[model samples]
Target: MFKKPVNDWKTSSPLRSSDRKKLRLKIASSYSIDTAEADVLVPEGILSVKFKSYLNEPGVAYLAPDGDRDPLWFSLGKGSDAQREDALLIPTIYTLWKMPKLLPSLSTPKAVIPIISGGADLMIPGVIHCPPSLNEGQLVSICKYERVDIDGAPTPMLSVPLAVGRMAVGSDQLQDSSQEKGKAVLVLHTWKDHLWELGSKKDVPPSEPIKTEDGAEENEDNTNSKAEEEVEDKSNSEMPANLEPVLPEVKTPTYTPDEVSQLLHMSLVQAITQSLSSLPASAFPIPATIFYTNHILPNRPHFPELVLHPSSPHEPPTADSPSTDSPSPDPSSITIKTSSHKSLTAFLKHAEKSGLISTKAPQKHSTQTDMLVTAVNAAHRDVETHHSFATIGEIEAKAARKAAREEDEKKQRAAANLEIDVQELWKPHLDSVELFEAMGESISKQYTAQEVRSLLNSYFATHQLVNPHDQAYIALDQALTACVIPKPKSKKKSPAEEAPLDQAKVEFMKRDELLKKVLNSMQNWYQVKNGDMGDEVALKKGKLAPIQVVMKMRQGRKASTLITGFEPFNIVAEDLSEDLRKLCAGATSIAPIPGKPANSGMEVLVQGKQSKSVVNYLVGKGVPEKWIEVQDATKGKKK
Candidate 1:
């Protein structure tokens, strides 16, 4: 029995305390031979011997128990002499009963060896006294007692060297010295011979006799010839093996005239003629039809059988189709037959063209394995666009683009239909001031600079007005008048004329008067339409400008309709009389005291001034104080 190497738990480790504990437990649980018994010689004053023997046959050897069981008998050898003692011997005592290998030594001062007689228990000299500290694998000689010599010279004690074990031995009989020694020697010799045979035979083959030196050269030649014969035999044993034989640069299969004739079973001239005629005109030979029904054909049983046709000068073999009794071909089956030596080379061009076979097919492939991977995502967009996973801005842009496209398409369709008046579709609102205001807002909201220009172009084109200035003015009026932006119509001209015509128009009209006129007209139109105020005071040359129109507003007002005007100071004073009463409105009153600085009286105050005379005096840097207060009191006569 073999013992697995034990891990010494006493060694230091990097493991944690718990892990080390578990490891120690596992090591402690690991197995080693625990109970082996052997007779070992201990150096002592009196000779001590121990032997284990069986009544049935003492000459038989035994093996120690696998673990903790008793030793059992095993036949090691036979003995010849009766005078010599023999006993069953355990071989692995050296491994199993070895000391210092986890087995505690027996503590009894005197060892007891058991005895047996007639297959029953008996007592004999017990264990041989041995030193307790012997290491494993150390050999020691033990003594065994035989019957006392006639003269009482203790019959030459049996001496046998033994390896210690973990078990102890007890026997009923003593072993004879000479017989045990001879038997031990025989066993050792037999085991050695067995080991030698095993080592020599490892991977070795059957032996052959060596040739003598005198015949060495001939033998070498013969060996070479024999090797060649062996190779030839090996080649011939397999199909297609002997077909292409090469010996370095020299090859065997090349044809001579005689070989060619022999192969074709015809004269050389005839064979050559047949070979030449069979070839096609093309440098590359016409591909032969290689395809056959997958299954053997039944109509001609043996139809594809290989045969040498008499008509062929070379007697080339053909696979004859099988003949059968059936009339209609079986749908589920097909067979192929082929010649042995010649190859079938089908062009397969039609098959490739028809897609039955791939044109550049791989030698071996699988459609499922070569399948294309499909995207998990499927989304549709216009032909000119791609699907997008849009952010907020991208979504807005896409929507804008789509709207623009739709508008263009609509304009195109409208132009395609010759209309009486495309603008008729959009009736300008004659009422609703609020709607007019909204229209401007919507235009600002929707149209970018480019789009505004495009709208203007289309509007002018639809109205058949070519002067861009006039066209733009009219378009602006129409938009404001309409109260909303009506879709613009598409324009067309000869491609060459369009570019220069577009250029002639002012690209921007930042201060155009026509635009302002249009805005005013639109405002009046909207004011009437909404019924907000049909009587809005239109500023005349002498009339005061409307105050509401002049004031600033929180919301931006379009400057288009707002006209700037200049008024005389008198008119301004008349208009602002109420507001002038408030000092915050930049108005003040003054009076004159007698012989003092001038104060307000009948001093003739002009527009926004305290008094006209006072103003005149200020301009002249002098004023009469008496006149500042008294102005034409009874013509300044009675007083």
Candidate 2:
């Protein structure tokens, strides 16, 4: 369920005061929550309740917001903490968030962080370490991977007990990989989720440093003044994936383009988002150059001499050193390369014009890219934010929403009406090799282009032939060789001669070209079947199985080889009839098969039983020897 608004939860009513007193009395009698932890939740014996819910029966919660918009705690536990999971003393929850000394801790593997945060049931596969005494339904605080700081210090970046969940299984079972596939935790409260949004939207308090084994407080600090000094200043507190714990808001220093690309490697969209997200408070509507140099360049990937001219390190008039000067302005500096934000800025403006993105327009000359771009709304909103990119948050979320939107559009279109395809797409014939696998050898059938494409898709999945890095690419396996586009023999040149462009020409990566390769890989089966230009008509290469010609006995016991199947060979029944008349001494007739539609099939009927002669005539007519199957009526069997 979506979280209730803060106004609905925030109250200092006398009834709530009485409720807190009663809840505190109940916790003291039942659970192990000491006075300090309970006081943090219900401070000064007053409940400045931010969220209250009796959604879960027999156990309700009163959430107190931290200096940051996040919950302190309340009641609700089940089964066992020191007892059965149910039967609670304020839920058996504990946290290492800000108060490491106040809660039980469990260190999960690196991969499990996003999984639990996204609200999926935490599975055992990603859990590397947990408390030995941790039992089912026990609430535990989750921390990220361990970190090593300078001066040989060890510390973990702590947030409020962001995730408090009941253990799905005992720690011992969690370690058993064979039995570790099921849920490991049922998370109750997580930081940045709906619950947190409804509470204290304040700055994260400075973390309490952890002590090292060497008896030193490696990174702890008691910064926040306790008792009524918990309110924190508001800031855009997004943790960009570039750095570990997001660096607090500051006037981000200007960086060269090379630096920015290193952090954000995907696209211009991500570049802009990371830039605006890391800005100092109230710095919005800044000039494009300031935004680009400070945000984009710093996060972008870098190259040597990206910040200054390559030769700028050595002054031209230096007393002791000779200097080289060049007129080329390329790569002079990030500022020059980005054309004073024109290059990167144009990319965004173009994206906006094309409807590929949505953002507030930059101030003209005042904007023409240099215009002020102020962000009024933060990334958390669904409304078009001022991130300078299309969407908010990380690349994964952007991709997910795009996929969902596309799917919805497809469903809507399908519901509206089926429109005729108007792109005028090209459809090509498959070669002999493709036909063998798709339609099979020695078979007479016609397949449409769509059918062939479906066959190609099936072949790819069944054989597991996909590029490991890019799913869109179909990696050609040995099985695909016969149905894949062949490489053109390169012309031998001088030993010293080389051209990178020539090499690039041979690699096909475009989707349409790759699909074309599927079609081009095939040699026209019809061309191979009929001798249109010469005496020799080709057959499927490496075809061990021959075409079949079988003679079946009629009701009167006379045998004849049906000639209807030769249509796939481009041979007409009329032609076969004429051929039969000559081969059978003018006793051949075109006879139709019953039980089928009119003109369903016609066979060459010879007056006397002569399956062998008919088969020999076909073999002599250029059909492969192995391709003919002679059905001997004498034995009433086909060979």
Top model by lDDT, which number?
A: 2
Taking all chains together, each candidate's TM-score versus the true structure is 0.11, 0.28
C-alpha local distance difference test of each model: 0.25, 0.46
Cα-lDDT of candidate 2? 0.46
Model 2 Cα lDDT, one tens digit per residue, 1-639 = 113222244443222555566555555444444332344445443333333343532223344432332344454434322123344543312223434434455544334455566666555544433556678877676654433354775444434444667788887776564562467677765555565565544334444332222222222222111100121121111111111111112121243454433223223344545555566657656565554444444433232222233333333333233222322222213332333323556644544454433446554555264544454222433223422322222343555697579767875665334321111122333444543455343324434446656766776676666666777777655445444545444657653454553354432243455566665554333323333334454333221223445566777676555554554444567887787788787566776755657755555567666667776766555554555666665576656
How does residue 455 of candidate 1 score in lDDT? 46
Indicate the worst ten consecutive residues by lDDT in candidate 2.
223-232
Q: After superposing candidate 2, which stretches have Cα over 4 Å from the reference? A: 1-12, 15-19, 29-37, 48-59, 63-70, 75-98, 146-160, 203-639
Off by over 4 Å in 1: 1-477, 481-511, 518-639
Give candidate 2's error at residue 118 in angstroms: 1.9
